[model samples]
Target: MKGQDYYIPAAAMAIALVFKLPALRNNWRDPLLRSVCVLLTLAGAVFTFAAPPTIDAVNEWTGIPNFSAPLVYCLMTAFSASCLVLMFNWRGGPAEEIRATSRRWISGYATVVVAIMVLFALGDAPEQRLRDFDTFYANTPYIRVMIAAYLLAHNVAAMTMVAMCWRWSLQVRGWLRGGLVIIVAGYAFSLTYDATKMSAVVARWLGHNLDDLSTYVAPPLASAGALISAVGFVLPLVCQRTSDSWQTWSTYRRLGTLWHEVQSTAPAGTPGVRMSWWSPAEIRVIQRESDIHDGFLRLGPCFDRRHRDAAYEEALAHGADEETARAVADAAMVAAAVRTSAADPEGTAAEDPGEGERVLIMADGPRDLVRISHALRHSPVVAATRRRATTADG
Candidate 1:
């Protein structure tokens, strides 16, 4: 169970590291990102050391008797410290407060690490006890206290995170709230891990074997908790980025019909090579918006205010709201302009005073442009106005 349990956290740790690598590299100064990276690295190291197969390999290569034991214990202590620091950094309070909190956690955990090393140094385990190190060393003089100390530290960190998350969860919402809840659940399992292992150790001291609790029961709980905690940390960032990309892509696709219609009237406004299907949503949206503005600029002289006014009245008659009617009126003028520009590019001129030089609709942003595009594509008033202008010219 110990060896098999390692793989679950190992995979999760790898995924977390990969996901945060860009943030880690690009924004190394970001405290939250840095803390998360450190936490994940320590977690991976703990899992790597916990596995008997990995411990044996390192022991054989290093030729240090029971070296993996101290290494694993130290790594676990560091993992606990990193986890707490990550929580503090994640739940930002104030700059000075964060620094003070971080400094205190570091100083306290450093003392715990030193104590674990000293206890390992005092213990005499000539042979390796890979599978049942805690049970085998349960009665060994200073080693017993050392194991107890490490478990104490582990339990303290677990309880602290659980309490912190539970309290903080009440103040947050959406992904952060949900994440805190999952983290609390994971830490609940962590507390179970501590209780079960401590029970096994105490049982060994009492001249009985509850080794199965440590060997069979606690490892899976620890593994499950670690995996869930990692996911809880990463879920918000991953889900948000995914949602933003989906929205950008949706907006890009929805604007396509309107962009095509305007682009036909002003072919130069079409971004032929740059507007490929392979282009990123952000780039395509920018280019599409730019081209729509350019196409409207070219159609300015052809805009007829009377035609726009008629379209607005017709839109109101069709039960369109004020905003929708305005958008329909603008789209109708653009459609009529496209026909006028197509007929006589040189001869086309607006007869209305001071209206010929003004830009059509202005575009403004994606929302305004999208609304106009929607009216151009689907509004019956825009189509009717376009047909009336075409007939008048004929």
Candidate 2:
């Protein structure tokens, strides 16, 4: 392939690696994260070293004809091993079992890499064939063995990944399943790459020439497959994180209505705890909820069960569902309490619930808080009750 084709993918992988580095540094013991980083590193190296311009440069710089051949082959072998190790870690089983399996794959591929280098050193390739080295030396003793060895290793890894990901996809759902399916498709392309390269090599062994398949057809397939596989590996992680962030921010926004209403009634100089601008959405939400509950506590003496009961009956009479009616009633009570607390800042005139009346404002969690916020913003019963409380206070 051309320099741009190879370098572009290399650059992309480098960017992906950079994004993962912080997480990897913090959780270096995490095998899955390590596997991902290693896979990206090896994949990028394979593309960079296999480019025709890079191959020619390495040969010239090293003063050895076709020295780039074994270098690229060993890189490809390690890349294949990284893919298998990543899949094993990603599938997840007993921790020990995962570790053992990954180690075995790494050891085996390391052996393959050593063997490729040994074969290349023993074989004589006096003529440098930058792009067509595999097919050009397909019948030259140890060179032929090296070519078959790398292709076989690559094919085995591709087939194994396709099978594993396909089976695992069936057992999962959502984005994970989609990612696995895409990974399977990517490895399918990898298999096609192996097929084309092997076809050219085998044809050369049989006194025929199909060098075009190896020289022209296989590199693109390899590049496309690697790119697709990288996307598949990344899709589920990026999408899930995005989904979580969106939900947290939505919660923070929805709670704004209730927080604002209660905050206005808090004592002067006690404006609740203010969060820094750089806080995460989750931390911001926690702070808002804390402030809201503090407001509810300050307004507790102002709560009157009678106001809630009247609003609840009004909401039910107007065809609201039970859950919504409860929310409306609670919102009405809170709205009236805000005005009562304002009218009697000393809280001496505040009335408690009767013997059997239950206080629900502080009983539940964030879900109830969101419902009350919705009711405060939208319920007519809550609005009317607030108006009546204002009139009475005046």
Candidate 3:
């Protein structure tokens, strides 16, 4: 039975471990700490599993029995208590005061837990033993206090953790915010069941009745808690991966829509017809390139930042000096800006391409052609610009 109680926590621990690895971030949001606590809870489960069966069958309390139940559960309590301590500590950032305070809190809790465990051990006496067959109970005074203190300590700690997570959810996000709460709630449920069982056992002993309510109440709650905590731990991993995928897809979709719009705007064979005006070239140009001129062609018009960077890198790598690279980069920027700006005012006299005395912004030069590769790599404007310049020059 105790084995069953610890198993859920064990499962929670295992799930939390996935977040602990260094490949993942070690922030408070991370589940590594939670995982450690669950594992410790699992350790508690082990002792409960081992001792409960023997106690349950002992109908008479007269034997000089080993009082390992509370002692072992105390160990579990320490693990659970330690978990709450860490969760509380996360509220403190880099400030020394917060850190010192958290440390002090942990130290105090630790002392209390150790002292309580020892008290339970020391307080047990042969005369105080409930030695009647067909009856089970804690008929001793100190035993009662030790159990109450331990449970009370755990309850206080677990609920505080839940409240902390709840408070953080006001501004927090992802798994840390949600998972912390779920884990806290689960532990809370399990602990409450435990405390309630302790209360019931006391009542049953006083009345000389043997009703194992703790056994009945605990396992199911622990299982439910295990499931909740497991979800809490794994949900963040799923959310993150999904978010990245959504962002990537959104970017590609935007780029695709832009490509279609540019294609439709170009006039047939006009190079950069209305649709193609802002687009890049399709055919790559092969002119004098630098030392590694054989690199991939990324044709772009005189615009497009990414395309321009690629062109700039290519130009420098292919042996073009800094002066040449700067000139090409600057010239492309000016042309792209000019084209975009010119298109803004429809019906304005300044936009008429055939108007006399206009330079026509010829993109036929060798410098322009080299940079076109960069534009083509980034946007559709490169191909359109190339076709326009080729037609105009011819």
The C-alpha TM-scores of every prediction are 0.85, 0.90, 0.52
What is the lDDT, from 0 to 100, of the residue 88 in candidate 2? 90
The full ranking of all candidates by lDDT, starting with the best, is 2, 1, 3
Task: Give a tens-digit lDDT track for model 1, residues 1-394.
Answer: 7576796678779787988898689899999889888888888888877888988988888887788887888888888888899899989889889989998988898898999889888888778877778888899988899899989998999999999999999998988899899989988888999999999999999999999898788888887787788778778767777888898888877778678877888655544645666777889888888777777777777777777888899899999999888888888988888887776667435554644344457656887778888998998888888797788666
Model 1, runs deviating above 4 Å: 19-23, 26-29, 92-100, 204-209, 267-279, 304-313, 321-323, 351-364
The count of residue-pair clashes in candidate 3 stands at: 39
- Model 2 alpha-carbon drift over 4 Å, by segment: 271-274, 309-322, 351-365
- Give the lowest summed-lDDT range of ten residues in model 1: 347-356
Which one wins on TM-score?
A: 2
Give the alpha carbon lDDT tens digit for every residue of 285-370 in model 3. Answer: 12122111211111122234543454456557767677556544433433343354335324253344443322222334434433
Query: After best superposition, candidate 1 residue 49: deviation in angstroms?
Result: 1.8
Give me the overall lDDT of model 3.
0.48
Q: For residues 51-81, what per-residue lDDT tens digits would candidate 2 score against the true structure?
A: 8899999999999999999999999899999
RMSD of each: 3.3, 2.5, 14.2
lDDT of every predicted structure (CA atoms) = 0.83, 0.90, 0.48
Give candidate 1's TM-score. Answer: 0.85
